[model samples]
Every structure is written in C-alpha cells, then in structure tokens.
Target: MLLALDAMGGDRAPQEPCRGAVRACESLPDLEVALVGDGKRLEPLLAEVSSNVRSRLHVVHTEEYITMEDSPSVSMRRKRNSSLRLALDMVRGKEAAGCVSAGNTGAIVAGGVLVLGRIAGIDRPGLGVPILSLSRTSLLIDVGATVRCKPVNLVQFALMGSIYMRCLAGVPEPSVALLSNGEEDIKGDDVISEAREILKASSLNFVGYVEGKDVPVGKTDVVVCDGYTGNVLLKFGEGLGEGVFGLMKEEIRRSFLPKIGLAFMWPMLRQLHTRFDYEKQGGTPLLGVEGTVIKAHGRSKARAIDNALRVARQFVLQRGVETIREEVAKGGM
Candidate 1:
C-alpha cells in the first residue's frame, strides 16, 4: 500500500521524517511512502538509505509547508501547494491509501474536513488515541479535534471510538463510557448528560459515566468525551507518567541498595516504560474523516514517524473508514 507523508511538518522535519520513511519502507517491504517536502533537503537524506529500501521511497517535492504557529484557516486558504496540503491531496485523489502528518493539528483538522470531507452521519471528525491502561488498552476519542461539541457529537464519538477499538484493537464488544466529573448518571454538563441518555438507548454496550481516574485503570474499552476534556486528560496523563518515571530514576540514583534492586527489576521496569511510551503508540487516528488520516505527535522523531506510518498502514488495512461509515449508518446518526 502507498501512503502520503508530510515530511516537512514535524519539529525534526525533513531529516527525521525522511529517515522514518526509509525505515518504514525497510520494515514493510510491500509498503511505499511518498514523502512530500523540499527535494533539495530530502534528497540528501534519501541518498543515505540503501538502494533496496530507497527505491520504495518516492519524493513528491513541495517547497511550501504549514508551520506549527500557522493559523488553520489562513494556512488552508493560502498554502495551497504546501507539503501538508499536497499530502492530503494525494489521499483525496486516491494516489495514496492514507495520509500521515506530524503537522499543525488545527490545519490537519481543517484540511481534513475541507479536502476529504466528513463521512456520512459524522458531524465532526474526532481524533482517537489508543491509551494503555492497567488492565487493558482503551480508546480515547476527541483528544483535540473538536473542542466545543454537542450531545450528538459526543454520541457520535462514542460510536466511532467503539468501532475503532473493535476493528483495530480487536475488541469484540467494546464497552463505552462518558468521561464525566463523577460516575453518577446525574453528573456532567448538559452535553454529557444528554449524550449518556442517548448512548444508553442505543444498541452499543454503553457502560454509563466514567470519571477521569477510571480512564487509567481501564474502566471502559472506549472513553468518550469532548475534545477539551479528552485533550486535558490525555496531556495530564502524559505528564504524570513522565513525572513518576523521573521520580523513580531520581530515587534509584540516591541509594546503592535501590540500584542493585533496579538491576534485578530492570526487565519489568523496561516493560512498564514501553507501555506508557508515546513513541511506540505512534499517532492517533482522525476518525470520522472521509479518508484515513493519522496525526503523529508534532515533536515526533524517526522511530515515532516510522510507527505512525505503520499505524496508517494498519488503519487502511483494517478498513477503518469503511467500518465507521457502516456503523454510523446502522446507528441512524
């Protein structure tokens, strides 16, 4: 399968993304990547890769690119020839099976909606991140796609999230829950409350409200919330994980006895670290869009970019977009 990548989007653009394209093509022999960026910058990087892997890496040169600080509206209107725009264009034109970018989240969302359009019955496209919890991995939808959402939007997010977990994560019947302030049915704002009721009535395995703490403990297979809430929760969890690991490292350095203990427990510690590693998780899917769009972290490097490309490949292979369309149509949304 062929995938279009915005090589000039991330913080380590061109270099890391270029190397990542080569790595992806190396790992997935059948996969091909069209790196969209400046030919001059990317050519030198591509030249370093072995001929066998380099052959699978195609460069679609574009001098323009959307910056992290660029306004979504302005960028979409003005940067018509940008790497980000061209990458999405490739997906829209069916030149590529999917599009991957570590670019401006706002620009990706806006461009995705305008260029790819929304799937039928999907009011807004939600970004779904696969969060690893204590018991199992759960899908969090609307991590930063649509901040201000309506009741119908949250319900739609739940539907999309459930479909994602089922198709990609291999959950037969993913349990869904609303991320509310409390677990009580009466808790949450008007939007959450109304969405809860609608979800409960639907055919989905709606498990009612799940508090913020419940998310990390794997209370539900799919945690549904507005983009604002989901974004805050996701970032907080990232910071907390880093802080805890840092504390562990600091404590380990403070004592010789702990150092010896760490030697014995290094395997388990490494496993724990890998579980919370965002690099391994790669990117989150912008569900509800017409085509496959995976949003890698803006600060992504080679490893992260390679994994994100793998994710895009898996998403397309799993027929994620088509599954969501079928589910949404069945729900009569």
Candidate 2:
C-alpha cells in the first residue's frame, strides 16, 4: 500500500510529519511511503530515529515548502515543487493510493479540486469528518472545504455523506439530516429550508431536521451544513472537550485523594480519551471526489498518519469512491 506524505506543510513541518511517516511505515510492515519534501534535510532525521522505517520510505523531493502564512492559491505557484502540490501529484498520477496533508487547508482543498478533480455530477466536494461518540459514529460534511453552499449543494453533500457512511462506515441505511436552528420545518434560512425539502425527496433515509445538540448525540448518521457553520460547530465541540478535560485535570491536582482516584481510574480515562481521538478514526476523507483524498489535521502526529495511511489503503482496496457514486446514483435514501 503506497501513500504520499507531505512532510513540509504543517507547523511542525518536516520533523513532525517525517517522524509520523516513519512511525506509520514501521507500524505497517506492508505500507510503502513516498515522503515528499527536501530529502537532504530529512536524511538526518531518519538517522536520529531508531526504526528501520528508512527501508520502506521512498523520498520524493519538493524543495519548496508551503507555510501556514502562504496564501494557498497564489503560493502554490511560487514553488514548482511545493510539498502540498507534489503530494497531490502523486495521487493524481496513481503513483500512490492517496496523499495525507496537514498543511494549509486552502492549499490542500484547492489542490484536491484542481488536481484530483470531483466525481461526476458532484457540483462541489466537502471534507467529511467522522464523529465518534459514546453511542455511535456519524459523519459531518463541509467541516472547512466550502465556505458557503446553495440548496442544491447541500442536497448533494447530504447524499454523498450518507453514501460514504454506508459504504465506508458500514451504516447500512444511514439517516440524512439537515443542520438546522430548530426542528421545525420553517425554522432555518431559505437555503437550509429548501435543502430540507429537496432532501425529503431524496431516495436515502431522510430523517428531517437535526439541531446542533444532536450532532454528537448521533441521532443521525449524516449531517449536512455549509462550511461556515460546520467549521464553527466542529471547533466548538473540540473546544468544549478540551475545556472540560482541563478542568478535570485541575480538579484532580487539587488534592492527594483526587490524584489517587485519578490514578485508579487511569484506564477508564485512557479509554475515554481514545473515544475522542481523531487519529483512531483516521483523517477526514474528502468525499464527492474522483478518488480518495484524506486530509490529516495540521497538528497530526505518528498515530494519526498511521491511521490515515490505513484509510487510504482501505479506500483503494474496497473501491470506496466508486461505491459512493453508485450509492448516490441509486439514492441510498
């Protein structure tokens, strides 16, 4: 299984991404990596790491690196061999099954749209983030891919996200829900209202409106929204988790008894942590596309990359994208 890793696109850049790729390679004996970046600088890091991952790592040179400060659309041209662009190229050329980028979201999305292209009849594509909660796992689309979308676009997003849950996540008949301000039919804006109406006519299992609170509650398997709202909701949930965990830590540190209790509950805490670990769920798969495009978080570490690579391998092996298109055509509703 061949996967391309963008080693110079995140805040941690070469070092972090390189280490993650090495970890992934070591973890998966059959995994082959085309690590894209400056080979000269990467060699030293490889020497420092103890693993024999160097044997499986294939270096793809990209002298120019994409920084978080660089404007994605224009900065892409500044370097003929930018890491993000090269990683996309590998996927486009079928040299690798997929490319994992933790760089500028704009560059990754733009490159995916321009280089990988969209699936037939898919007007726009959204980043589908799988949400794992206590009861179930669901998918939320347009986490940050498109800033805005129309009613038709929302309908398409719902269909694609639903199909993905069925094919990839194994939700036999995933329920589709429109992200709304309220459960009432007339509660949302015209765009969302119209999307709701259109989705009601869709062949998939349309389950009416889903509010923000229902998001992590797993009432629906697919939640569709414009990127503006989707991104805010996603970040909000993440922030809440962090805040609660911080408070819990502080409380535990306040007393020796609490510290002892925490130590005893360490296993449970670890299990709880894994429940929300994005790495365990893999990178957000870019749906409504011609091929698989897994976008790892910019701060992703070793385990995340390992899981992302596995996601790529799974998509190719199962022909996931093709099944999604077929399911959409059949209107899984």
Candidate 3:
C-alpha cells in the first residue's frame, strides 16, 4: 500500500521523516511512502538505504509547509502547496491510501475536514489516541479536534471510538464511558448528561459516567469527552508519567542502596516506561474524516514517524473508515 507522509512536518523534519520512511519500507515489504517535502533535502538522507528500500521511497517535493504557530484556518486558506496540504491532497485524489503528519494538530484537523470532507453522519471529526491503562489500552476521543461539542457529538465520538477499538485494536466488544467529574449518572454538564442518556438508549455497551480517576485503571475501553477535557487529561497524564520517572531517576542517583535496587528492578521499570511512552504509541487517528489520517506528535522523531506510518497502514488494511461508515449508518443518526 502507498501512503503519503509530510516529510517537513515534525520538529526533526526532513531527516527524521526520511529515515522513518526508509525504516517503514524495510519493515513492511508491501508498503511504499511518498515523502512530501523539499526533494533536495530529503533525497540526500535516503542515500544510505538499501536499493530495495530506496525504490519504495518516493519524494513529492513541496517548498511550502505549515508551521506549529500558524493559525489553522489561515494556513488552510494560504498554504495551498505545503507538504501538509499536498499529503492530504494525495489521499483525497486517491494517489495514496492514507496520510500521516506530525504537523500542527489544528491545521491537520482543519485540512482534513476541508479537503477530505467528513464521513456521512459524522458532524465533526474526533481525534482518538490509544493510551495504556493498567489492564488494557483505552481509546480517548476528541483529544483536540473539536473544542466545543454538542450532546450528539459526544455520542458520535463514543460510536467511533468503539468502532476503532473493535476493528483496529482487536477488542471483541469495547465498553464506552463519558469522561466526567464524577461517576454518578447525574454528574457532568448538560451536554454530558444528555449524551449519557442517549448512549444508554443506544445499542452500544455504554458504561455510564467515568470519573477522571477511572481512565488510568482501564475502567472502560473507550472514554468520550469534549476536546477541551480530553486534551487536558491527555497532557496531564503525559506530564505526570514523566515527572514520576524523573523523580525515580533522581532518587536512584542520590543513594547507593537505591542504585542497587534499580539494577534489580530495571526490566520491569523499562517495560512500564515503554507502556507510557508516546513514541511507542505513535500517532492518533482523526476519526470521522473521509479518509484515514494519522496525526503524529509534533515533536516526533524517526522511531515515532515509523510507527505512525505503520498505524496509518493498519487503519487502511483493517478497513476502519468503511466499518465506521457502516456502523454510523446503522445508528440512523
């Protein structure tokens, strides 16, 4: 399968993305990547790759690119030939199966809606990220796609999140819950309360309200919330994990006994670290868009880029978009 990649999107840009494309091509035999960026910069980086891998890495040069600080609407309107825009264009034109970018989240969402259009019955596209919980990896939707959402939007997010977990994550029947201040049915604002009722009435395996504490222990397979809440929770979890690890490292360095303890506990700690690492998780899918679009972290490097491409490949291979369309249609929304 051919995938379009924004080679100039991330903090490391060109170099890391180029290396990642080569690595992805090497690992996935049937996969090909069209690196959309300045060909001059990207071509040199591919020189060391084997001929087989090099052959699969195609470069579609574009001088323009959207910056992290650029306004989403302004970027969409102005940067017509940017690497980000071109990559999405490839997907819209069917030149590539999907697109992956570690660029501006706002720009990607804006461009995805404007260029690729929304799937039938999807009011707005919700971004879903798979976060590692104690028992399982839970999918959190609307991590920054739509800040203000209606009751119907949350319900639609739950549907899409459930479909994503079932199809891509291989969950048999994903349990769904709304992220709220409390677990009581009466908790949350008007939107969440109304959404909870609607979800309970639907055919989904709705688990009612889930407090913020419930998310880390795998209380539900899918957690739904407005983008504002979801984004704050996602960032806080990331920061907390890093702060905890940093403290542990500092404590280990301060005393000899802790150093010896670290030697004994290194394997388990490393495993836990990997579980929470964003690099390993790669990109999050922008669900409800017309095509498969994986949004990698803006600070992503080579390994993260490689995994993000793999994610896009899996979404296409699993026929995720088609399944979502079918499921949403069945809901009569």
Candidate 4:
C-alpha cells in the first residue's frame, strides 16, 4: 500500500521525515512510500537507504511547502502545489492507503476533513492520542482536535476510541470511561452528565467516570471528553510525569545510599520511564475521517517519524478506516 508523507512540513523538515521514511521503506517490506516534497533535497537521503528500500521509495515533487507557522487556510487558499495539499490529494484520490505527517498538525487535520472529508454520520473527527501507561496503553479522544463538543460528540469519541484500541492495540472489550472531575456521576457539568448517560446505556464496556488521575492508571481503554478539558488533562498528566521523574532524580543524587539504591533499581526505573515517554506512541491518529492522518509534534525526531509511519502501515493493514466507517454507519453517531 502507498503511504503519503509530508517531507517538508516539520521543524527538521526533509531530513528527519526523509530519514524516517527511509527507515520504514527498509524495515517494512510490505509498504511503499511517496515522499511528497522537493525532490532535489530528498534524493540524497533516499540514496542512503539500501537498494531494496530505494526501489520501494517514490518521490512526488512539489515546489511549495506548508510552513509550521502558516495558517491552515493559507495552504487551502493559495498554495495549490504545496506538498501538504498534494499529499492529502493522493489520499482523497485513493492513490494511497493513508497519510502520515509530523508537520503542520492543524493543517493536516484541516486538510483531512476538507480534502478527504469525514466519514458519513460522524459529527466531528477526534485526535486519538494513545496514552502509553505501565499496565496498558489507552486512548484519549478529542485531545485538542475540537476545542468544543456536544454531548453526542463525546459519545462518538468513546465509540471510535474503543474501536481503535480493540482493533489496533489488540484489546478486547476495552473499558470505556467519560473523563470527568470526580468519580461520581453528578460531578461534571451537563455535557459530562449527558455523555455519561449516553455511554452507560450503550453496548460498549462502559466503566463509568474516569477522573484525570485515572488516566495514567490504565484502568480504561477509552476516556472521552471535550477537546478543551482533554488537552488540559493531557498537559497536566505530562507535567506530572516529568515532575515525578525530576524529583526522583534530585532525591537519588542527594545522598550516597539513595544513589546506590537508585542504581540498583535503575533498570526498573528506566522501563517505567520508557513506558510513558510520549514519543513512543509517535503520533496521534485523526480518527473518524475516511482516510488516516497521523499528527506528530512539530519538533518530532527521526525515530518518532519512523514510529508514525509504522502506525500508518498498521492502520492500512488493519483496515481501520473501513472498520470505523462501518461501525459509524451502524448508528454509532
């Protein structure tokens, strides 16, 4: 299957994205990539890949690029030859199975809806951020995809999240939860309460309320919330994870015995740290769209971009786009 990549869209631009594309071509034999960007800059990096990989690599040149700071509409209105626009066009045209980008998250998302269009019956698409935790990796939907959402939007988010976790992450009967301030049903505002009722009555394995603290605990596979609350909770969780590790490092260095103790438990600590490293998940999948679009941070590295392509590959073979669309057609919305 063809995977379209935005080579000139990230902070590191062609180098990091091209390096990652090269990695995917070399390691994943079943996949071919279309490097959408300036061919002159990408040719050298493509040469570094093995001959077998080089054969699988394809280049689609475009003079324009969607800059990180450029408004999403600017690309839509003016930059017709932009790599980002053309890469999306390939997906809409069915020339590629899916698309992956570590650059221009907003533009990629906007282009997904505008270019490829959303799956019919879907109210709004969600940014499916896979939350890697100690016990298991769960998904947080609407994590900055839509700043505001109706109660029905949260319900669809729960449905899409559960389907993603079960199919891609290999979790069955994945527990679903409504992200809220308290475990009690009456804690949040009307939207949360309405979503709770909708989810609880549904066929999913709804496990009731999941507070912010329950996210890293890995108690549920899906946590649905409006984009605003989800973003705040996500950032807060990331800060907490960093803060805990920082405090532990300081304490470990404070005394001789502590340092020795940390050294003894270093492997375990390292494993725990790697579990929630954030980049390990690589990128967030923009779910509910007809085509797949994985959005990575603007400051992504080669390894992260590599993982993102791996994700797109999995999405294609898993037939997640078809599955989610079918599920939605069954009155999921």
Candidate 1, residues 251-333, lDDT tens digits: the string is: 99887888999899999988877787743359888999999999998878888899999999998999988988887788732
Q: lDDT values of the candidates?
A: 0.89, 0.81, 0.90, 0.83
Minimal lDDT window, size 10, model 2: 273-282
TM-scores of the models, in the order given:
0.96, 0.94, 0.96, 0.90
Tell me which of candidates 2 and 4 scores higher on TM-score.
2
- Return the TM-score for candidate 1, rounded to 2 decimals: 0.96
**Per-residue CA lDDT of candidate 2, range 1-333, in tens?**
888888886677788778778877777788888889998988887886555777788888768888888876777666558988888888889888888887887777777877888877788888888888767888888888888889988888888887788777788888889989999897999999998888888677999899988988888999999989988887777677678789989988786788988878989987776676543346877887776778777777766766777777787788877887777666554
TM-score of 2: 0.94
Root-mean-square deviation (CA) per prediction: 1.5, 1.9, 1.4, 2.4
Span of ten consecutive residues with least summed lDDT in model 1: 272-281
lDDT of 2 at 97: 83
Tens digits of per-residue lDDT, candidate 4, 180-217, equal 88998779889889988988789889989988888888
Model 2 regions lying over 4 Å from their true place: 48-52, 279-281, 329-333
